[model samples]
Target: MSKWAYSTDGFDRIVHRIDGVETVTYAIGQGEPLVYFHGGGTFHGFEWVRPLAGEFRVFCPYHPNFGESGDAELGGMGDYVAHYEMLFPALGLDTFHLCGASMGGHMAARYAAANPLDVEKLALVSPAGLKSDRASIPDFSKVAPQDIPAMFVADPAWVAPFWPADPSPEWAALRARESAAAFASREDLSLTDRALREGLKGFDRPTLLLWGENDRIVPLGYVPEWEAVLPHAELEIIPGGSHLLLDEFPAAVEALRSFLKG
Candidate 1:
């Protein structure tokens, strides 16, 4: 039996194929669909948008090879777009909101561009397409597990509590295995970092760029470039929040609501 846990949001776990790969998605809520793409690694999609389910009908799908989804024939931004293109129409979503975090932001932007006429709004949270000026992408395999928090957040103190106070031997072993799978997919990260540079300049749809002011992973300087790309787009930089601002700062969630609702 699949150990994947379902949600109380009344979402049903459904599977559909795209290019011979089986993808899993949680379909629930009501009204216009909000298709949320997950960040890099093994995170399930609904966990990414659980907080916003009450506001919009959320469609959170796992990318092939992530979570319960199977591997794709190929892995790349184009492959992801093709998969979503099929998945979207299958759900009967003619027009809907789109939001993504980290690598998912890259995929979301690519998908929106491919289907410009279909997306109602776009939201990117600490997106990953733009390369950092000074910080190179860290290799998880090389870094000490203890150093992981610093790479992803500004304050390690805030996140340490989330880990088990005294993790059992079994718990630690499982976590290591989970981390390995996440690192295995590192190559799938979108390489078209410069594609959104000029293309987003003329994007007329309502767009929001939410950044963590203290984000050390992606840096805070990219805000200017993002503003340049979508001059009319709104930006909300959460003070003291790190790369995982949406999870780190509850107020940031309210900001997202205001931006998307408006």
Candidate 2:
């Protein structure tokens, strides 16, 4: 087993094989099901979903090629969407609330747009999909591993837990795998799919767009594009927040709680 395979309080760690890919999932809480797709570099564990356990059963899955999850034969966003199609049924989830961050947000949007009926509600935190002529996503490939944290959060301290003073060989290998997975997912330079934008217009499901006002990776300027595509989406911009707004700001969780409940 990998060093990051253990379960934490309120979350039961389990592995499920869906379509030949073994997926690591953290199941927590009790009420309605809330599937959470975490951001990049969060494959170790889901401390962010711990607070949401009070009201919902949050299932955080490590996407294929990330963490302990087995790699899929295919690549691209569609392959991921298809993986979840098989995964949801194996988990006995017919319909559930969906929440995703950054790259996960991009996947959630594509999933929800394709299977609107399966998603009761959708929450995207600083999502990466949706192209804006004015706003540009930073080239993470060019960023140094140590300096990458600053690009995600407004405060550098938020990433201290993930980056140890002296990382072991195993830890470094894990980080390398995560970085590779991220790049593989975006083989096409265009992260935002034009088809997804059109599909989102027809989603009609209750949607929430939570973003950091100061996000450097996926700028705040893309909010209008998202709003334009998802006409009914409720938009909330966190002040002084960056790409990792949910991590930097606790209020985003409360907002999510209220939105999910409402």
Highest TM-score against the true fold, candidate:
2
Model 2: weakest 10-residue lDDT segment is 1-10
Question: Highest lDDT among the candidates is held by which one?
Answer: 2
Model 2 stretches astray by more than 4 angstroms: 1-7, 187-191
79-104 in candidate 2: lDDT tens per residue? 89999999998888999999999899
Structural similarity to truth (TM-score) of each candidate: 0.81, 0.92
Residues 15-35 of candidate 1 have per-residue lDDT tens digits of 887668787887776666788
